[model samples]
Target chain A: MSTWSPSASRDALMARQQMYRSIREFFYTRSVLEVETPLLSQAPVADPNITPMQAGQRWLHTSPEYAMKRLLCAGYGDIYQICKVFREGEAGKRHNPEFSMLEWYRVGWTHQQLMEEVAQLLQMLLAERFSTLPTLHLSYAQALQSYAQLDVHHCGDQVIARHGQALANADLDLDRDGWLDVIMSHQVEPALPHNTLIFIDQFPASQAALAKLANNEQGVLIAQRFEVFFNGMELANGYQELTDAQQQLQRFKHELQGTQRSHDALLIAALEHGLPDCAGVALGLDRVLLHLLDAQSIAQVLSFEWQRA
Target chain B: MANYSSNEFKPGLRVMVDNEPCIMIDIEFVKPGKGQAFSRVKLRSIRTQRVWERTFKSGESLESADIVERDMEYLYSDAEFWYFMATDGSFEQLGASSEAVGETIKWLKEQVVYEVTLYNDAVVSVTPPNFVELEVVETDPGLKGDTAQGGSKPATLSTGAVVRVPLFIVEGEKLKIDTRSGEYVSRA
Candidate 1:
């Protein structure tokens, strides 16, 4: 392997730069203020799965979620940031330990509106390849039924057991949300067609993370969250903001899997000070670039994936 | 043998699964947003020659397969068993399982030794030289003056592997064949 050379070609790199420039323009037209946040924090995220790279007493930021939310609480109406975030033990065709993320928050919009905006932005960015890319919406239940032919809410237990049978270990031990994610990521995401913006929305309430929960027309409690997948890659995840201080604290605890961080208290305080009703999202910029280039691996769009770095 | 953590996973690594030694063929890291991470992997069992997919929770460890690769030459088989000898003159277990021989068994030409992969003292795989010269043991008589550019016919080699060769090639003619594909390369 030529480690000395950049992972992406000069032409692809130029396209990336152009994509970045166009993204800024897209937000600028909407009057979304571009903002920057600290790359490291004194406290780590409780989300046990996302192990943050630590530097002595401080930990590198996983995503600008908490800090960006703090900004939202400080009354920064519509803001966006494109920055590099760090996560440990993630490397492959699509993942690098460190990757670029484009995060933004809107004061008066819902995740649904944000999803439409995302589709519009993608169409703007990929105008050269696609004249008009159609956006497809699928509720979490519809996605499972369409892709794996299983019901996420009703037949969850049996589906997990059957899905686990294929695994080497830890079969059927995971919770409902865990099984949904495993099946969704491995099956539904990649099977999505090219040039279509697929929005898988209304997640299970248990896996809500920081999103707000509401009942769908079917009366099942679902989280107001949606994920965007393009050309078989998960490009972005967004949520209708959760502003209840107590609820936010509980979600933070649930995210920490087992680790505890002092920032949880600070975030709770911010929520108590009142984060405005808003929707927010963090998109993987590298993956978006990969989709635009129609490249098989994320390395083709990134200047230096984890390997080269 | 040493154990391997999920972070150390890569292609070509051998690890035991359910007491059978399997080689890691492909692996991809998958982590759902804000959820448990997993390494989806594909493995081929040397004992059964069955390729299957498996998933492991991140941070999980695997037992080493105690596998080793050595340069060896293919020896004649005893009908039920195929044998090979290392370049250093050391004899292998004297019998290789059919599963270990794989499809390469069709191209196994005696005296044309190959590099063999072993696990726990049993031959699990053999790699033949890219090109091997074998006499065509069976084929229709060449059409008197058929040139190499004309039609082709099936020819059986000394290894019993059939390959399509130029119409000019007839029985008893030595031909070079690609062991990997069991295809005719050229007249030797």
Candidate 2:
């Protein structure tokens, strides 16, 4: 059923172009360099859920994370890229297999600092269409305790199933991590203020993908990471850089390979070459546009969705 | 009897949960960028009429509900059982105390057909047609020269339904009532 017409309307397509211009203008004023890297590379994502598409013997770059980190090691300082990213088995109202990503890194900044900058960018974008949203800086531990009434470090599966309406009648056989994910995704995220920008920081260490571990004010270990949610959609995730090569390798093995080392030697080597202390983030550009345009689905804003493409 | 994966979940799907039949009322797909995807659903219990949310991990399978719906003609109810006949002339029976027929028992009329939902070969629930014509069993005498918009008064129908009809509508006059809303539609 291939058609000649574009999925989006003339006005929406025009709005998309205008939005891109605003994003570039936002970064340009800050002197953050715009850069581009190869979309196809041999390095694959350690996150198993993001299966990269194969092109000959190479793999499609999942997020341009590794290559961007390499540039940081070469003393490129702060840089940003807006490009298409690929993932597999993810298709729905909020997700598409291929979508645009707004990824950037700031040299000499902590995850907390980057989170403040992210808030400024989103507030700037939302101000153009909707009124400016006040940022709600909420710790992940506090959100669960307030909304779900469970201890983050010590909560069990039974408590989560009985906690909120999201998993109110969930199976008692679910694991601890499984229950946490369900509660956070459905219960906590939705209950956050819709007209406000939400920043949830300090996640469980088990979910720390590439982030460095840090001690919270309570002397408990937490990942130096943060996620942003707006209008009931997860818009971005950021992490404090993990600079030690040995520890980076260990984390990749634990997170991706199930206790086995991966074939990705390039990222570790780049870390060994001394990546400057920095924080980086990746945001879903399509989802952001959906909220800005008051559209229900990502397909409405995009020129063509996966099925149409 | 059948199986469905979380990816197959949608509204109006019936699935068995914890040994009781339930129907899915709503479903929303929630997935993380690098973690398990879950189908967040709202399910209404067929027996209790209670609705609650459930989250199923992607690729997880659920047993399809052993529920069936058919066109059944209403038959007389003995003290203990409400009987109905299928179009093929087969009789089906449900206990009067069964959850399916709890509220429907009040609006039932003799010899009227209904869309009956059955679970495990027993009647679970019945839905009457959207519009049913029933004679007004009780009403005040009509005033002279009353038209459709003059006024409306409460009239009791043969199926134990109470509706507000125009002032010209009197006892024994057939009136069309919207079964879903129990409102007067027009003269039959």
TM-score of each: 0.92, 0.85
Q: Please, what are the lDDT tens digits per residue for candidate 2 over residues B52-136?
A: 8777767788899888878877777775777777765656544434356675664677677787877887767777778777899
Query: Please, what are the lDDT tens digits per residue for candidate 2 over residues A95-144?
Result: 87789999999999988889999988888777767776888988889988
**Each candidate: RMSD to true structure?**
2.8, 4.0
Off by over 4 Å in 2: A1-7, A48-58, A151-168, A172-174, A257-263, B32-35, B44-50, B66-68, B71-99, B106-113, B118-123, B140-154, B164-168
Q: Judge candidate 2 at residue A232 and give its lDDT.
A: 78
lDDT of 2: 0.80
Best by TM-score: 1
Q: List chain B TM-scores, each candidate.
A: 0.85, 0.82
What C-alpha lDDT do the candidate models reach, one value each? 0.83, 0.80
lDDT of 2 at B183: 85
